[model samples]
Target: MMKEQWVKDLSTIVNPQDVKIDEPLKNYTMTKLGGNADVFVMPSTEEAASEVVKYAHLHKVPIFLLGNGSNMVIRDGGIRGIVLNLSKLDQIRIDGTTVYAQSGALIIDVSKAAAAKSLTGLEFSCGIPGSIGGAMAMNAGAYGGEIKDVIVSCKVLTPTGDILELSKEQLELGYRKSIIAKNGYYVLSSVFELQKGDQETIDATITDLTFKRQSKQPLEYPSAGSVFKRPPGNFAGKLIQDSGLQGKGVGDAEVSTKHAGFIINKGNATASDYIDTIHMVQRVVKETFDIDLETEVKIVGEDLPTDKNKTL
Candidate 1:
């Protein structure tokens, strides 16, 4: 738990009910494996969220910004200081040809909203399961499209609590990386400019992509969406499959037999189990192909100290 005075101070800025101490993070993450957070605050509005950030900055509390928790893994040792969850900030609005979404809005929900308005550019994101903020932070993509392709500008709250609207060029969006991520800025909202398209075409595109995702990815099990980024010219999944590690298992964590790219929780999987599996896959792939696999999933927090030293 955080200092009582700090918690009480933050409660005055955000909704009192939204504040929690020693909150388990597994329930919020996509992989459903993590320890607790010292303090968790879900602000209902952008202003409230900014206020929380300001308070943390003034008090010298380390603050972690949490979106939908899709492409991240919080280690077994609980995170210290304050964790700001943006889940309550979800709000998507359509204005003319532009779609505005609060940082906490799910990308799939934004795609659906755009589709309802016959917007064509966001079709590729219909199957993405991250929040708009996280997608922007990592320049998230799927099926040949990414956030960089459609985004115009975004509002962000700096670490020092200053809010600024940044253009696409300033965002410096690249393959699974962005300025927002490198600078540790908190995304407040994003504005996307999309073209008008036939409603049938938009719906069909979403359907086709949805089918591809459902068919190729292991959606049945709990796992972080793609364990590693596409390594250079080679696909991570293909490399792992070629290395004969498709069905590898470490405790309750297993490489998906259906898709080598994912490490799934086969019931009762600990964060350690998942981390070990990822390491095993990386080691095998590196040894066989001489390719260092870089992880797309963000692993943070401390590790649990154990007596056993298991080498991959």
Candidate 2:
């Protein structure tokens, strides 16, 4: 249980209204399945965010920085300490051919901003649902373009609350991983360098990618996109589909028939259903093809007690 005094103390660092106790986390994530966060804090400014992080560190409470929750699953038993949501800090600005985006700014929105300025190189991320912070943490990429290609530098808050500016090389961006993730650093903002381009050409590229995504991916249902990372020299989706695991599910969680890479919440699905389905797919793929499927989706929090005969 969260201590009342501890909850009240958070108000000293952030607005009282922004601090919540036993806050439901399901409302925050894409899948909309989870219990509660013992302490949920939303700071609208970088200064306030830093203060909160520092206070949590000083108090020895566990802290998790949450973005738009586009690629995560919070387990059924909920999160124990602080869950810092950066959604309120969204901001974006354009200067010449460079884009300055706050961590909370959506990547899709940033891509759109670049297009509006007639800047090229960001059209690839026009459909990604994640925020800049999450994108930086995972080196998020799509349609042959990754954040590393455009990012000039980033501002981040260290776990101990010190701010640092990291260049692209310093970020150590890789396929679905970065130094921010390895060190649990909190991204504050980023600068993306682009180039002047014809508006017609940029618009055409975005249109093409959007069509490809809508046609191939299952956007109608709720899911943490691309459940598993691509194994070296192989695609996770192809392996699952070839292994005949399509449409397989536990309860209401199903491997998307449209795209095998996705696991969708088929309405009334529990976190357990999603996890169990993931394990089932992994086990089947490994046994059938002898290739391991590593999860790309971030799974956090705790699970409900194992039920010998669980229902729903």
**lDDT by residue (tens digit), candidate 2, 1-312:** 355766788888888999999899999988988889989999989999998889889989899998999999889999988999999889999999989999999999999999999999999999898999999999999989999999999999999888999999999998899999999899999999999999999999999999999999989988998899999999999999998989999999999999999999989999889999999999999999999999999899988777889778
Question: How do the residues 1-312 of candidate 1 rate in per-residue lDDT, one tens digit apiece?
Answer: 346777799889987888888899998999998998888999999999899999999989999997888898889986888999998888999988999999999999999999998888999999888999999999999888989999999999999998999999999999999999999999999999999999998888888999999999999988999999998788999999999998887899999999999999888998998999999999999899999999999998777676477775
For each candidate in the order shown, give its overall lDDT on alpha carbons.
Answer: 0.91, 0.92
Give the Å error, residue 281, model 1. 0.6
lDDT of 1 at 260: 92
Q: Lowest-lDDT window of 10 residues in candidate 2?
A: 1-10
The alpha-carbon deviation from the true structure for residue 308 of candidate 1, after best TM-score superposition, in angstroms, is 10
Following a full C-alpha superposition, what root-mean-square deviation does model 1 have from the true structure? Answer: 2.1
The C-alpha TM-scores of every prediction are: 0.97, 0.97
